[model samples]
Target chain A: MDVYKNLDWEAVEKLKISSGSKIVLKRDLNFLRSEENISVQFLLDGEVKGSVDCHLCLDNKDIDENSRNYLYPYFTESMNILLGRLISTDPMLSALKIKLSPPKCTIYSKTIDSRLMSELVVYSLVINDFDFDVVLNLNLTVIN
Target chain B: MKEIIPLSELRILVVDDSDFSRSMILQILSEAGCQLVTETNSAEHAMKLIREKKPHIVIADIVMPEISGIELTTKINDNFDNIYVIMISSLSQEHVVLEAISSGASDFISKPVQKNQLIESIQKIAQNISKE
Candidate 1:
């Protein structure tokens, strides 16, 4: 089965959070996406890091300043949910021992890690007007 | 108020590290006519409230700071008698699910929790408790 096809995107789409609510799942790992707003990385056993970013995935850009500050966490939460749901449905991915870190608001574009074998390729999800680049920095052996 | 099987009498505690996730859960619970709902951002506070307030059901995130949902569930099972735990998280790994169920979770709801699943799980646990 195509692993990309197995990843569920329906649940996220059903959540009509507000205006301009939409999500696109890019199967091509190399799929070029836009800038980042929020990113969450899942590090598995110090080897693989599965990163999910909701670059500018906000439905209501017009939300008040106070609401906007509060809303940033929701984007992070969305990325968390996106990755969690992806792993849940896929058996192979779930079997690995992974430690999920708290979501982070990424500023700099994701770059290469020099210490060990890593990769930054996963499904880059673009929602609304924002870009969420998901990079899994791990050996390509795991990808296959 | 219209009578429903899952009444408003359920004292529930919502536990998660995310303010957004907590608010979202509270909104859904309130919409379902839940009267007494408490929100906490982490497992430690949730444990304290579970002791003081003694909620019937706990909707918690599996991955949390300090202690994980699995650890919390184990503690609750070992100490509490009638508390029902429904672990909700963005990560739905098989081991996480297994550990949650083994630790004493009544149900495991994957994050981005759906309304139907949330209601059904709560009601099912309620119904089972009533049967006993």
Candidate 2:
């Protein structure tokens, strides 16, 4: 069974609504070239083994201090909510035991090198007229 | 009528690696009339604070860098009595919840925690503490 197929898409839509953001699926990896990015990764164990990397695209915009304070935590919590919903709400996934490590955040001063990565998913979203991107790199194994 | 434990009287400690989560939890506790609340980003520091503050409830995130929340719960169970742990995490699989419960967590809460759920859990535990 395809793990992606079993994901709870309604959760994704809920995420957009809760964040008050409009999301567009981006086919290219251009979001990786942003000047600054916040990357949060979770380590999965149990029935699923691997890591899920969620990135927030914050380019060279002059964001104010208030925006920075709000956006960072908002983005982190959004990732947590999305991933938690993805695993716990899905019929197939909820039945299987899985552990997600605490999401770890890192800020990059340069563009991410996507050429070396495989199985990348990108979502470009606009929240309050400020553009942000969510990049997911799933390297997973589902134990039968 | 449900006996309302004055949240302000319950000393609580919240441990999470995410600044966002910690702040959100603190805000919730504050609004709910909780007065004594302490927070830490690492489980390592949480242990020291637990020793120092001796809070009635400890809200912990399951995932962390040095020591995971499960380990922390186990440690608390071993060394302390009546220190209820509320485990919070993004993963809600059956085994994960079971593991947390087995590790001595008084309650389990999923991440992006709902305010009512957290308060309810805390209230339940606080009431239990009052009984003992």
Candidate 3:
């Protein structure tokens, strides 16, 4: 099964409702090295097992430390809501019994860990005029 | 005049690993006129706080590091009385909701919780608490 094709973008679009931000899909991987990025990984387990990583970048360079700290959690929670909606609302995902782990945030690094999945290509999600890059490293395999 | 639901009188405890989720929840509760609110990052610590704080309501995230909210609900049901558990999560699957209710949660709420929904849930519980 084509994982990306089967997945529902509408369910993921629930992020817009949660964050009160409009999301636009961008083809370019426009993440800048100069800007500090926040990344978090949510581990998925069950018949389909793997992980989803979200890398978020802010447009405003002048944001203070306190604001950055606040946005970090907001980003994680936004993704958490999106993933949960995807699992529950998506017809394909809801049929399967899947368990999602709590999100584990990591220090911002430009490198994508190749050991998990080779699809380093990211879908840039522009939210509230800021760029949010989502990298899905899901190792999709049916476990019997 | 009908007696108003004393949302301020109900002590609420929020348990979630994400600082953002907790802050959002805190802001919602505060805006809803709830004054006595306590928050914890882990279920283990939540259990400890329950012993000391004895909050009337517990709003917990289903996904966590050490112990999950479901396990915490079971613990609360086994040990405590007159305390209600509201299970909150991004995983809003029917089975997950059933599991939460079966685990002894009084209510289940999906994430990005609406302020009105939360307040209604709390109000229902508050009314019950007032009667007791």
Candidate 4:
């Protein structure tokens, strides 16, 4: 089968992650080519907030939950790659004010903060029994 | 006879704030038979390495702590007369690219460095070296 037929870009957002690469996933096409990971709402420029959350599968079967923390940098680099694809495909945004702040990672907790409400548009995919998701929670803005 | 420079013979420095990015770039360069490649997680350290090792090419990320890639490029332009800077970033905005070039980048590549893309860049730079 031709894998090229399955690869194409849809639309995407140009948001940023805390200390991560520039945020570029805003739609289905771009997300399809990207790896899985998480992005929160604290990074975007406007009052419109929420995170571009991503899900990715680890290639190494050796990593268990205990060593999962070791994969943090990988996930960050993956985001950079994904964002690069979007930018490469779209050259028009080069002139915008396009301010980018440093990536700010938040520890997961049980409670939702003030600016982010949980309005979610979620998509899920499973390949070879490994599942992935990319979610955009617009109401899920972050305060930072 | 005129001499030719291959990617393997060139000295390179990979600069980024992320450890994974540095490792990933390093892996790609190494796989392409690059012999002299060094990596630093920040632009500050990049300057020191540039002065010490004097790599022919500097592949750098734009958004970084302490020093952004544009500033670093400016520094290189001012002090380092012979080094070529390649700007890499997740930010694809037009203004950002222009800023990088104006600041002294010889070329620009977006993040998520692909092997072919990098090799092609190295070849282009190597060709320029041969020409000069």
Q: Top model by TM-score, which number? A: 3
Runs in model 4 deviating more than 4 A are A1-9, A12-67, A81-95, A107-129, A134-144, B130-132
Q: How do the residues B1-132 of candidate 3 rate in per-residue lDDT, one tens digit apiece?
A: 345448887889999998878987999999989998999999999999999999999999999998999999999999999899999999898889999999999999998787889898988878677522
Candidate 4: TM-score, chain B only: 0.93
lDDT of 4 by residue, A1-144 (tens): 121122233434443322333434334433222222434322433321333443443333445665456455555555555544443454332222444444554334223221343443334322233334434333222223
- Give the lDDT of residue A25 in candidate 4: 38
Of 1 and 2, the candidate ahead on DockQ is 1
Model 3 lDDT per residue over A30-99, tens place: 4333245668888888866777777775534566888677677777777787778878888888777788
lDDT of 2 by residue, B1-132 (tens): 455457888899999988878987998899899999999999999999999999999999987777999999999999999899999987787788999999999899987777899999998887776622
Pairs that collide in candidate 3 are none
- Candidate 4 local Cα displacement, residue A104, angstroms: 1.8
**Residue-level error in angstroms, candidate 4, position A122:** 4.0
Docking class of 3: medium
Query: Candidate 1, which segments miss by more than 4 Å at Cα?
Result: A1-22, A27-38, A46-64, A106-144, B1-6, B129-132
Provide the TM-score, chain A, model 3.
0.69
lDDT of each: 0.65, 0.79, 0.77, 0.61
Query: How many clashes in each candidate?
Result: 10, 0, 0, 19
Ranking by TM-score: 3, 2, 1, 4
The worst-scoring run of ten residues by lDDT in candidate 3 chain B lies at B1-10
